[model samples]
Target: MIELNVAIKDKYYENSETAVLSQLDFKVNSGEFLAIIGPSGCGKTTLLNMISGLESCVGQHISYSSNSSGNRFKKNDLASDCSKSEYLENEQANRIGYIFQQPRLMPWLTVRENIELVLDPTQFNKIEGLLAEVGLAQKGDYFPSQLSGGMQRRVSIARAFAINPQLLLLDEPFNSLDAPTAGRLRKLLLDLCREKKTTVVFVTHDLQEAIYLADRIIFLSDSPCTIIHESIINFPKPRTESGIAELEFQAKLTRQFPLLLAGKID
Candidate 1:
Protein backbone atom coordinates (compact mmCIF):
# COMPACT_ATOMS: atom_id res chain seq x y z
CA MET A 1 0.00 0.00 0.00
CA ILE A 2 2.91 2.29 -0.72
CA GLU A 3 2.63 5.11 -3.25
CA LEU A 4 5.44 5.16 -5.86
CA ASN A 5 7.10 8.35 -7.01
CA VAL A 6 9.35 7.70 -10.05
CA ALA A 7 11.64 10.47 -11.16
CA ILE A 8 14.24 9.03 -13.50
CA LYS A 9 16.66 11.76 -14.45
CA ASP A 10 18.31 9.56 -17.05
CA LYS A 11 19.22 5.96 -17.91
CA TYR A 12 22.17 4.94 -20.07
CA TYR A 13 22.96 1.38 -21.02
CA GLU A 14 26.41 -0.10 -20.69
CA ASN A 15 29.13 1.27 -23.03
CA SER A 16 26.61 3.60 -24.68
CA GLU A 17 26.74 7.36 -24.28
CA THR A 18 23.25 8.25 -25.43
CA ALA A 19 20.52 8.18 -22.82
CA VAL A 20 17.81 5.62 -23.29
CA LEU A 21 15.68 7.58 -20.84
CA SER A 22 15.83 11.18 -19.73
CA GLN A 23 13.94 13.34 -17.27
CA LEU A 24 10.99 10.96 -17.05
CA ASP A 25 9.07 11.66 -13.87
CA PHE A 26 5.68 10.60 -12.55
CA LYS A 27 3.84 9.48 -9.44
CA VAL A 28 1.82 6.33 -8.85
CA ASN A 29 -0.69 6.88 -6.05
CA SER A 30 -1.15 4.10 -3.51
CA GLY A 31 -3.57 1.41 -4.68
CA GLU A 32 -3.77 3.13 -8.06
CA PHE A 33 -3.54 0.85 -11.09
CA LEU A 34 -1.42 2.81 -13.59
CA ALA A 35 -0.24 2.01 -17.13
CA ILE A 36 2.64 3.24 -19.30
CA ILE A 37 2.33 3.16 -23.11
CA GLY A 38 4.72 4.28 -25.78
CA PRO A 39 6.37 3.45 -29.12
CA SER A 40 8.56 0.38 -29.51
CA GLY A 41 12.11 0.75 -28.14
CA CYS A 42 11.01 3.95 -26.44
CA GLY A 43 12.57 3.03 -23.13
CA LYS A 44 9.28 1.88 -21.63
CA THR A 45 10.96 -1.26 -20.34
CA THR A 46 13.96 0.74 -19.22
CA LEU A 47 11.78 2.97 -17.10
CA LEU A 48 10.20 -0.03 -15.46
CA ASN A 49 13.63 -1.47 -14.85
CA MET A 50 14.66 1.70 -13.06
CA ILE A 51 11.52 1.74 -10.91
CA SER A 52 12.02 -1.92 -10.03
CA GLY A 53 15.68 -1.11 -9.27
CA LEU A 54 16.93 -3.51 -11.95
CA GLU A 55 18.67 -0.65 -13.72
CA SER A 56 20.68 2.22 -12.31
CA CYS A 57 19.09 5.65 -11.88
CA VAL A 58 20.96 8.88 -12.44
CA GLY A 59 19.22 10.80 -9.71
CA GLN A 60 16.79 9.76 -6.99
CA HIS A 61 15.52 11.71 -4.00
CA ILE A 62 13.23 10.02 -1.50
CA SER A 63 11.38 10.95 1.70
CA TYR A 64 8.12 10.41 3.54
CA SER A 65 5.89 12.43 5.87
CA SER A 66 3.57 11.15 8.57
CA ASN A 67 -0.16 11.47 8.04
CA SER A 68 -3.18 10.54 10.12
CA SER A 69 -5.33 9.27 7.24
CA GLY A 70 -2.99 6.24 7.11
CA ASN A 71 -1.47 7.40 3.79
CA ARG A 72 2.02 8.01 5.19
CA PHE A 73 3.66 9.06 1.90
CA LYS A 74 3.42 11.47 -1.03
CA LYS A 75 4.94 11.41 -4.53
CA ASN A 76 8.36 12.93 -5.26
CA ASP A 77 8.78 14.23 -1.72
CA LEU A 78 12.37 15.54 -1.86
CA ALA A 79 13.35 15.77 1.78
CA SER A 80 16.91 14.58 0.96
CA ASP A 81 16.68 12.02 3.76
CA CYS A 82 17.72 9.21 1.39
CA SER A 83 19.36 8.83 -1.96
CA LYS A 84 17.48 7.30 -4.89
CA SER A 85 19.52 4.12 -4.76
CA GLU A 86 19.19 3.79 -1.00
CA TYR A 87 15.43 4.26 -0.96
CA LEU A 88 14.67 1.84 -3.79
CA GLU A 89 17.04 -0.78 -2.39
CA ASN A 90 15.79 -0.65 1.18
CA GLU A 91 12.07 -0.12 0.67
CA GLN A 92 11.36 -2.33 -2.34
CA ALA A 93 13.37 -5.44 -1.55
CA ASN A 94 11.35 -8.67 -1.14
CA ARG A 95 8.18 -6.58 -1.58
CA ILE A 96 7.94 -6.30 -5.38
CA GLY A 97 6.37 -8.71 -7.87
CA TYR A 98 7.47 -8.23 -11.47
CA ILE A 99 5.74 -9.88 -14.40
CA PHE A 100 7.83 -9.69 -17.53
CA GLN A 101 6.84 -9.70 -21.20
CA GLN A 102 7.54 -13.42 -21.27
CA PRO A 103 6.46 -15.95 -18.68
CA ARG A 104 10.18 -16.59 -17.87
CA LEU A 105 9.31 -19.86 -16.21
CA MET A 106 11.44 -22.95 -15.88
CA PRO A 107 10.33 -25.67 -18.25
CA TRP A 108 11.24 -28.46 -15.83
CA LEU A 109 9.32 -27.09 -12.87
CA THR A 110 5.65 -27.64 -12.19
CA VAL A 111 3.35 -24.64 -11.99
CA ARG A 112 3.15 -24.97 -8.23
CA GLU A 113 6.90 -25.22 -7.93
CA ASN A 114 7.54 -22.09 -10.06
CA ILE A 115 5.40 -20.04 -7.71
CA GLU A 116 6.99 -21.62 -4.66
CA LEU A 117 10.33 -20.33 -5.94
CA VAL A 118 9.36 -16.87 -4.65
CA LEU A 119 7.60 -17.73 -1.37
CA ASP A 120 8.71 -19.03 1.99
CA PRO A 121 8.32 -22.75 2.66
CA THR A 122 5.60 -22.01 5.23
CA GLN A 123 3.67 -20.08 2.58
CA PHE A 124 3.70 -23.07 0.24
CA ASN A 125 0.11 -23.81 1.16
CA LYS A 126 -0.98 -20.59 -0.53
CA ILE A 127 -0.02 -22.05 -3.94
CA GLU A 128 -3.25 -23.97 -4.42
CA GLY A 129 -5.46 -20.93 -3.85
CA LEU A 130 -3.23 -18.76 -6.02
CA LEU A 131 -3.42 -21.22 -8.93
CA ALA A 132 -7.18 -21.35 -8.52
CA GLU A 133 -7.40 -17.58 -8.57
CA VAL A 134 -5.67 -17.47 -11.96
CA GLY A 135 -7.91 -20.18 -13.45
CA LEU A 136 -5.27 -22.88 -13.09
CA ALA A 137 -6.77 -24.85 -10.23
CA GLN A 138 -6.26 -28.22 -11.90
CA LYS A 139 -2.97 -27.50 -13.63
CA GLY A 140 -0.70 -27.04 -10.64
CA ASP A 141 1.28 -30.15 -11.56
CA TYR A 142 1.76 -29.15 -15.19
CA PHE A 143 5.08 -27.78 -16.36
CA PRO A 144 5.51 -24.68 -18.53
CA SER A 145 5.94 -26.82 -21.66
CA GLN A 146 2.56 -28.46 -21.26
CA LEU A 147 0.45 -25.33 -20.90
CA SER A 148 -0.63 -23.06 -23.75
CA GLY A 149 0.88 -19.57 -23.99
CA GLY A 150 -2.08 -18.00 -22.27
CA MET A 151 -2.05 -20.65 -19.58
CA GLN A 152 1.63 -20.14 -18.94
CA ARG A 153 0.98 -16.45 -18.56
CA ARG A 154 -1.65 -17.36 -16.02
CA VAL A 155 0.93 -19.23 -14.06
CA SER A 156 3.18 -16.18 -14.25
CA ILE A 157 0.38 -14.00 -12.94
CA ALA A 158 -0.27 -16.44 -10.15
CA ARG A 159 3.39 -16.40 -9.21
CA ALA A 160 3.53 -12.62 -9.10
CA PHE A 161 0.51 -12.34 -6.81
CA ALA A 162 1.78 -15.17 -4.64
CA ILE A 163 4.01 -12.74 -2.76
CA ASN A 164 1.15 -10.35 -1.99
CA PRO A 165 3.51 -7.63 -3.11
CA GLN A 166 2.91 -4.08 -2.01
CA LEU A 167 3.83 -2.97 -5.56
CA LEU A 168 3.35 -4.95 -8.77
CA LEU A 169 5.11 -4.10 -12.02
CA LEU A 170 3.89 -5.69 -15.24
CA ASP A 171 5.81 -5.15 -18.50
CA GLU A 172 3.20 -5.98 -21.08
CA PRO A 173 2.43 -9.29 -19.43
CA PHE A 174 -0.31 -10.03 -21.95
CA ASN A 175 1.38 -8.74 -25.08
CA SER A 176 1.68 -11.87 -27.18
CA LEU A 177 -1.64 -13.55 -26.45
CA ASP A 178 -4.63 -13.62 -28.77
CA ALA A 179 -7.39 -11.04 -28.29
CA PRO A 180 -9.92 -13.36 -26.67
CA THR A 181 -7.28 -14.84 -24.43
CA ALA A 182 -5.70 -11.46 -23.62
CA GLY A 183 -9.07 -9.95 -22.78
CA ARG A 184 -9.83 -12.80 -20.40
CA LEU A 185 -6.46 -12.43 -18.69
CA ARG A 186 -6.85 -8.67 -18.42
CA LYS A 187 -10.12 -9.16 -16.56
CA LEU A 188 -8.46 -11.72 -14.36
CA LEU A 189 -5.68 -9.23 -13.56
CA LEU A 190 -8.18 -6.46 -12.89
CA ASP A 191 -10.06 -8.67 -10.47
CA LEU A 192 -6.86 -9.54 -8.66
CA CYS A 193 -5.86 -5.88 -8.45
CA ARG A 194 -9.22 -5.00 -6.95
CA GLU A 195 -9.12 -7.86 -4.47
CA LYS A 196 -5.56 -7.08 -3.38
CA LYS A 197 -5.62 -3.31 -3.91
CA THR A 198 -1.93 -3.57 -4.76
CA THR A 199 -0.21 -0.61 -6.39
CA VAL A 200 0.39 -1.46 -10.06
CA VAL A 201 2.46 0.14 -12.85
CA PHE A 202 1.76 -1.82 -16.00
CA VAL A 203 3.79 -1.11 -19.15
CA THR A 204 2.24 -1.66 -22.54
CA HIS A 205 2.01 -0.42 -26.13
CA ASP A 206 -1.74 -1.00 -26.32
CA LEU A 207 -3.89 2.03 -25.60
CA GLN A 208 -7.18 0.16 -25.43
CA GLU A 209 -5.65 -2.35 -23.07
CA ALA A 210 -4.36 0.50 -20.92
CA ILE A 211 -7.81 2.11 -20.81
CA TYR A 212 -9.33 -1.17 -19.83
CA LEU A 213 -6.96 -1.90 -16.95
CA ALA A 214 -5.53 1.35 -15.58
CA ASP A 215 -6.94 4.04 -13.34
CA ARG A 216 -4.44 6.40 -15.00
CA ILE A 217 -2.39 6.11 -18.18
CA ILE A 218 1.04 7.65 -18.82
CA PHE A 219 1.98 8.13 -22.48
CA LEU A 220 5.59 8.59 -23.46
CA SER A 221 7.53 9.89 -26.45
CA ASP A 222 9.75 7.73 -28.68
CA SER A 223 13.20 7.80 -27.04
CA PRO A 224 15.13 9.64 -24.38
CA CYS A 225 11.67 9.08 -23.10
CA THR A 226 9.58 11.56 -21.15
CA ILE A 227 5.91 11.84 -20.33
CA ILE A 228 4.12 13.45 -23.25
CA HIS A 229 0.64 13.00 -21.85
CA GLU A 230 -1.32 11.31 -19.10
CA SER A 231 -4.93 10.23 -19.27
CA ILE A 232 -7.02 9.57 -16.18
CA ILE A 233 -9.53 6.79 -16.77
CA ASN A 234 -12.70 7.83 -14.97
CA PHE A 235 -14.73 4.90 -16.16
CA PRO A 236 -16.16 2.64 -13.49
CA LYS A 237 -14.33 -0.53 -12.52
CA PRO A 238 -14.97 -3.93 -14.13
CA ARG A 239 -15.17 -2.24 -17.54
CA THR A 240 -15.72 -4.12 -20.76
CA GLU A 241 -13.49 -3.79 -23.80
CA SER A 242 -16.45 -3.56 -26.17
CA GLY A 243 -18.54 -1.31 -23.95
CA ILE A 244 -19.97 1.74 -25.76
CA ALA A 245 -18.28 3.97 -23.21
CA GLU A 246 -14.88 2.39 -23.79
CA LEU A 247 -15.24 2.59 -27.59
CA GLU A 248 -16.50 6.17 -27.55
CA PHE A 249 -13.71 7.33 -25.27
CA GLN A 250 -11.18 5.70 -27.56
CA ALA A 251 -12.67 7.35 -30.63
CA LYS A 252 -12.54 10.77 -29.03
CA LEU A 253 -8.98 10.22 -27.85
CA THR A 254 -7.75 9.18 -31.29
CA ARG A 255 -9.49 12.15 -32.85
CA GLN A 256 -7.92 14.51 -30.33
CA PHE A 257 -4.47 12.99 -30.58
CA PRO A 258 -4.49 11.62 -34.09
CA LEU A 259 -1.03 10.11 -33.86
CA LEU A 260 -1.21 9.05 -30.26
CA LEU A 261 -1.34 5.35 -30.98
CA ALA A 262 1.60 5.82 -33.30
CA GLY A 263 3.64 7.19 -30.38
CA LYS A 264 3.65 10.70 -31.72
CA ILE A 265 2.37 13.67 -29.75
CA ASP A 266 1.57 15.52 -32.93
Candidate 2:
Protein backbone atom coordinates (compact mmCIF):
# COMPACT_ATOMS: atom_id res chain seq x y z
CA MET A 1 0.00 0.00 0.00
CA ILE A 2 1.16 3.54 -0.74
CA GLU A 3 0.67 5.89 2.18
CA LEU A 4 0.87 9.68 2.73
CA ASN A 5 0.93 11.58 6.03
CA VAL A 6 0.84 15.43 6.03
CA ALA A 7 1.35 17.59 9.08
CA ILE A 8 1.95 21.35 8.94
CA LYS A 9 3.37 23.27 11.86
CA ASP A 10 3.24 26.89 10.72
CA LYS A 11 4.08 29.12 7.77
CA TYR A 12 4.44 32.83 7.31
CA TYR A 13 4.19 35.25 4.40
CA GLU A 14 6.82 37.98 4.57
CA ASN A 15 7.37 39.28 8.11
CA SER A 16 3.79 38.67 9.16
CA GLU A 17 2.80 35.12 10.12
CA THR A 18 0.09 33.52 8.01
CA ALA A 19 -1.26 30.15 8.91
CA VAL A 20 -2.32 29.14 5.41
CA LEU A 21 -2.43 25.58 6.62
CA SER A 22 -2.04 24.27 10.13
CA GLN A 23 -2.08 20.90 11.80
CA LEU A 24 -3.29 19.08 8.67
CA ASP A 25 -3.30 15.30 8.79
CA PHE A 26 -4.46 12.62 6.35
CA LYS A 27 -3.45 9.19 5.01
CA VAL A 28 -4.05 7.48 1.67
CA ASN A 29 -3.43 3.84 0.87
CA SER A 30 -2.52 2.13 -2.37
CA GLY A 31 -5.13 2.14 -5.15
CA GLU A 32 -6.99 4.69 -3.06
CA PHE A 33 -8.02 8.06 -4.50
CA LEU A 34 -8.38 11.03 -2.14
CA ALA A 35 -10.00 14.37 -3.05
CA ILE A 36 -9.58 17.72 -1.33
CA ILE A 37 -11.86 20.72 -1.91
CA GLY A 38 -12.31 24.14 -0.38
CA PRO A 39 -12.98 27.78 -1.21
CA SER A 40 -10.37 29.90 -2.95
CA GLY A 41 -7.57 31.33 -0.77
CA CYS A 42 -8.37 28.63 1.74
CA GLY A 43 -4.91 27.19 1.48
CA LYS A 44 -5.90 24.04 -0.36
CA THR A 45 -2.98 24.61 -2.74
CA THR A 46 -0.81 25.46 0.26
CA LEU A 47 -1.59 22.09 1.78
CA LEU A 48 -0.76 20.41 -1.48
CA ASN A 49 2.55 22.26 -1.62
CA MET A 50 3.54 21.04 1.83
CA ILE A 51 2.67 17.49 0.86
CA SER A 52 4.55 17.84 -2.40
CA GLY A 53 7.39 19.57 -0.51
CA LEU A 54 7.37 22.54 -2.92
CA GLU A 55 7.34 24.85 0.08
CA SER A 56 8.72 24.27 3.54
CA CYS A 57 6.43 24.56 6.52
CA VAL A 58 6.96 24.45 10.22
CA GLY A 59 5.68 21.70 12.51
CA GLN A 60 4.73 19.28 9.74
CA HIS A 61 5.95 16.00 8.38
CA ILE A 62 5.30 14.36 5.02
CA SER A 63 6.25 10.70 4.72
CA TYR A 64 5.75 7.86 2.28
CA SER A 65 6.18 4.11 2.48
CA SER A 66 4.81 1.10 0.60
CA ASN A 67 3.68 -0.80 3.69
CA SER A 68 0.84 0.30 5.93
CA SER A 69 3.31 0.26 8.81
CA GLY A 70 5.20 3.08 7.11
CA ASN A 71 2.06 5.25 7.12
CA ARG A 72 1.34 5.30 10.84
CA PHE A 73 1.55 8.36 13.09
CA LYS A 74 5.15 7.65 14.03
CA LYS A 75 7.60 10.11 12.48
CA ASN A 76 9.90 8.68 9.84
CA ASP A 77 13.52 9.15 10.85
CA LEU A 78 14.55 8.60 7.24
CA ALA A 79 12.84 11.80 6.03
CA SER A 80 15.99 13.74 6.85
CA ASP A 81 18.11 11.87 4.33
CA CYS A 82 18.85 14.02 1.27
CA SER A 83 18.07 11.23 -1.15
CA LYS A 84 14.84 10.30 0.59
CA SER A 85 14.01 13.96 0.95
CA GLU A 86 14.61 14.50 -2.76
CA TYR A 87 12.40 11.56 -3.62
CA LEU A 88 9.58 12.81 -1.38
CA GLU A 89 10.32 16.43 -2.01
CA ASN A 90 8.10 18.51 -4.24
CA GLU A 91 7.59 16.74 -7.58
CA GLN A 92 10.66 14.52 -7.60
CA ALA A 93 12.16 13.86 -11.06
CA ASN A 94 10.27 10.70 -11.94
CA ARG A 95 9.08 9.06 -8.69
CA ILE A 96 6.23 11.55 -8.15
CA GLY A 97 4.13 12.86 -11.04
CA TYR A 98 2.06 16.02 -11.22
CA ILE A 99 -0.79 17.05 -13.56
CA PHE A 100 -1.34 20.74 -13.19
CA GLN A 101 -4.56 22.68 -13.90
CA GLN A 102 -3.36 23.40 -17.43
CA PRO A 103 -1.86 20.93 -19.87
CA ARG A 104 1.39 22.95 -20.05
CA LEU A 105 2.71 20.95 -22.97
CA MET A 106 5.54 22.25 -25.12
CA PRO A 107 4.19 23.67 -28.38
CA TRP A 108 7.23 22.48 -30.31
CA LEU A 109 6.94 18.84 -29.32
CA THR A 110 4.54 16.30 -30.71
CA VAL A 111 2.41 14.29 -28.31
CA ARG A 112 4.79 11.35 -28.54
CA GLU A 113 7.84 13.53 -28.02
CA ASN A 114 6.20 15.36 -25.10
CA ILE A 115 5.48 12.11 -23.33
CA GLU A 116 8.94 10.79 -24.12
CA LEU A 117 10.61 13.94 -22.82
CA VAL A 118 10.46 12.78 -19.22
CA LEU A 119 11.40 9.19 -19.97
CA ASP A 120 14.93 7.81 -20.09
CA PRO A 121 16.39 7.21 -23.56
CA THR A 122 15.84 3.47 -23.32
CA GLN A 123 12.18 4.01 -22.31
CA PHE A 124 10.76 5.55 -25.53
CA ASN A 125 8.90 2.33 -26.29
CA LYS A 126 7.28 2.54 -22.87
CA ILE A 127 6.12 6.03 -23.80
CA GLU A 128 4.57 4.74 -27.01
CA GLY A 129 2.67 2.10 -25.05
CA LEU A 130 1.42 4.63 -22.53
CA LEU A 131 0.07 6.92 -25.25
CA ALA A 132 -1.85 3.94 -26.56
CA GLU A 133 -3.11 3.19 -23.07
CA VAL A 134 -4.48 6.73 -22.77
CA GLY A 135 -6.19 6.45 -26.18
CA LEU A 136 -3.81 8.89 -27.81
CA ALA A 137 -1.96 6.53 -30.18
CA GLN A 138 -3.50 8.10 -33.25
CA LYS A 139 -2.59 11.61 -32.14
CA GLY A 140 1.05 10.84 -31.38
CA ASP A 141 2.38 13.06 -34.15
CA TYR A 142 0.24 16.07 -33.32
CA PHE A 143 1.66 19.09 -31.48
CA PRO A 144 -0.06 20.66 -28.49
CA SER A 145 -1.33 23.59 -30.56
CA GLN A 146 -2.82 21.22 -33.10
CA LEU A 147 -4.94 19.28 -30.61
CA SER A 148 -8.10 20.29 -28.81
CA GLY A 149 -7.93 21.22 -25.13
CA GLY A 150 -9.17 17.82 -24.06
CA MET A 151 -6.63 16.02 -26.23
CA GLN A 152 -3.81 18.13 -24.85
CA ARG A 153 -4.91 17.33 -21.34
CA ARG A 154 -4.96 13.69 -22.31
CA VAL A 155 -1.35 13.99 -23.37
CA SER A 156 -0.54 15.62 -20.06
CA ILE A 157 -2.16 12.70 -18.29
CA ALA A 158 -0.23 10.25 -20.44
CA ARG A 159 3.05 11.96 -19.63
CA ALA A 160 2.36 11.81 -15.91
CA PHE A 161 1.72 8.08 -16.05
CA ALA A 162 4.41 7.18 -18.57
CA ILE A 163 7.21 6.96 -16.03
CA ASN A 164 5.07 4.91 -13.63
CA PRO A 165 5.42 7.05 -10.53
CA GLN A 166 4.46 5.78 -7.11
CA LEU A 167 2.45 8.86 -6.07
CA LEU A 168 0.38 11.14 -8.33
CA LEU A 169 -0.67 14.67 -7.53
CA LEU A 170 -3.44 16.29 -9.54
CA ASP A 171 -4.37 19.93 -8.98
CA GLU A 172 -7.77 20.50 -10.63
CA PRO A 173 -6.84 18.45 -13.66
CA PHE A 174 -10.34 18.58 -15.14
CA ASN A 175 -11.32 22.14 -14.47
CA SER A 176 -11.97 23.64 -17.91
CA LEU A 177 -13.06 20.85 -20.20
CA ASP A 178 -16.61 20.22 -21.25
CA ALA A 179 -18.61 17.96 -18.92
CA PRO A 180 -18.58 14.92 -21.18
CA THR A 181 -14.84 15.06 -21.81
CA ALA A 182 -14.04 15.59 -18.16
CA GLY A 183 -16.23 12.66 -17.13
CA ARG A 184 -14.68 10.38 -19.72
CA LEU A 185 -11.18 11.38 -18.75
CA ARG A 186 -12.02 10.88 -15.09
CA LYS A 187 -13.10 7.28 -15.64
CA LEU A 188 -10.11 6.56 -17.85
CA LEU A 189 -7.74 8.00 -15.24
CA LEU A 190 -9.35 6.09 -12.37
CA ASP A 191 -9.06 2.83 -14.24
CA LEU A 192 -5.49 3.48 -15.27
CA CYS A 193 -4.42 4.46 -11.76
CA ARG A 194 -6.06 1.39 -10.32
CA GLU A 195 -4.24 -0.84 -12.76
CA LYS A 196 -0.93 0.85 -11.97
CA LYS A 197 -1.53 0.67 -8.18
CA THR A 198 -0.66 4.34 -7.89
CA THR A 199 -1.89 6.36 -4.94
CA VAL A 200 -3.57 9.61 -6.09
CA VAL A 201 -4.15 12.89 -4.34
CA PHE A 202 -6.56 14.96 -6.43
CA VAL A 203 -7.61 18.51 -5.68
CA THR A 204 -10.95 19.63 -7.03
CA HIS A 205 -14.07 21.63 -6.18
CA ASP A 206 -16.50 19.43 -8.07
CA LEU A 207 -18.36 17.20 -5.66
CA GLN A 208 -19.36 14.71 -8.33
CA GLU A 209 -15.78 14.46 -9.50
CA ALA A 210 -14.68 13.69 -5.97
CA ILE A 211 -17.44 11.11 -5.49
CA TYR A 212 -16.69 9.33 -8.72
CA LEU A 213 -12.93 9.22 -8.38
CA ALA A 214 -11.90 9.23 -4.74
CA ASP A 215 -12.03 6.58 -2.04
CA ARG A 216 -12.42 9.40 0.47
CA ILE A 217 -13.09 13.15 0.44
CA ILE A 218 -11.24 15.59 2.64
CA PHE A 219 -12.88 19.04 2.85
CA LEU A 220 -11.02 22.12 4.01
CA SER A 221 -12.20 25.33 5.61
CA ASP A 222 -11.48 28.87 4.32
CA SER A 223 -8.06 30.54 4.46
CA PRO A 224 -5.59 29.37 7.10
CA CYS A 225 -7.26 26.07 6.42
CA THR A 226 -7.28 22.72 8.15
CA ILE A 227 -9.43 19.70 7.53
CA ILE A 228 -13.02 20.63 8.30
CA HIS A 229 -14.67 17.32 7.43
CA GLU A 230 -13.98 13.99 5.78
CA SER A 231 -16.32 11.46 4.16
CA ILE A 232 -15.57 7.96 3.02
CA ILE A 233 -16.71 7.10 -0.50
CA ASN A 234 -18.36 3.83 0.40
CA PHE A 235 -20.29 3.52 -2.83
CA PRO A 236 -19.46 0.48 -4.89
CA LYS A 237 -17.15 0.77 -7.88
CA PRO A 238 -18.18 1.14 -11.53
CA ARG A 239 -19.99 4.35 -10.63
CA THR A 240 -22.42 5.96 -13.04
CA GLU A 241 -23.74 9.48 -13.56
CA SER A 242 -27.39 8.99 -12.56
CA GLY A 243 -26.70 6.32 -9.97
CA ILE A 244 -24.03 8.40 -8.30
CA ALA A 245 -26.50 11.19 -7.58
CA GLU A 246 -29.17 8.66 -6.60
CA LEU A 247 -26.79 7.18 -4.03
CA GLU A 248 -26.96 10.42 -2.00
CA PHE A 249 -23.27 11.10 -2.46
CA GLN A 250 -24.05 14.52 -3.90
CA ALA A 251 -26.57 15.32 -1.21
CA LYS A 252 -24.21 14.16 1.52
CA LEU A 253 -21.55 16.46 0.20
CA THR A 254 -24.02 19.30 -0.22
CA ARG A 255 -24.89 19.05 3.45
CA GLN A 256 -21.24 19.56 4.25
CA PHE A 257 -20.62 22.31 1.71
CA PRO A 258 -21.58 25.06 4.11
CA LEU A 259 -19.11 23.98 6.70
CA LEU A 260 -16.52 23.24 4.07
CA LEU A 261 -16.72 26.79 2.76
CA ALA A 262 -16.69 28.23 6.26
CA GLY A 263 -20.48 28.61 6.31
CA LYS A 264 -20.74 30.60 3.13
CA ILE A 265 -23.67 29.69 0.91
CA ASP A 266 -21.93 30.57 -2.32
Query: On a 0 to 100 scale, what is the lDDT of residue 234 in model 2?
Result: 78
Local distance difference test scores for all models: 0.82, 0.76
Candidate 1 structure quality by residue, lDDT tens digits, 68-113? 2565652334323456565655654437789999999988899989
For model 2, how does the per-residue alpha-carbon lDDT over 1-266 read when each residue is reduced to its tens digit? 45676655555555666766666777877667899877777777766765666765433566766564654444342233335455444334327778889999999999988988988888887876788888888899988999999999899999998878788999999999999999889988988888888989999887777878888988887767777788887777778865845358677667756455452434
CA error at residue 38 for candidate 1, angstroms: 0.2
Candidate 1: segments with Cα more than 4 A from true spot: 61-71, 74-94
Highest-lDDT candidate = 1
TM-score of each: 0.90, 0.86
TM-score (C-alpha) between model 1 and the true structure: 0.90
Off by over 4 Å in 2: 14-16, 68-94, 244-247, 256-266
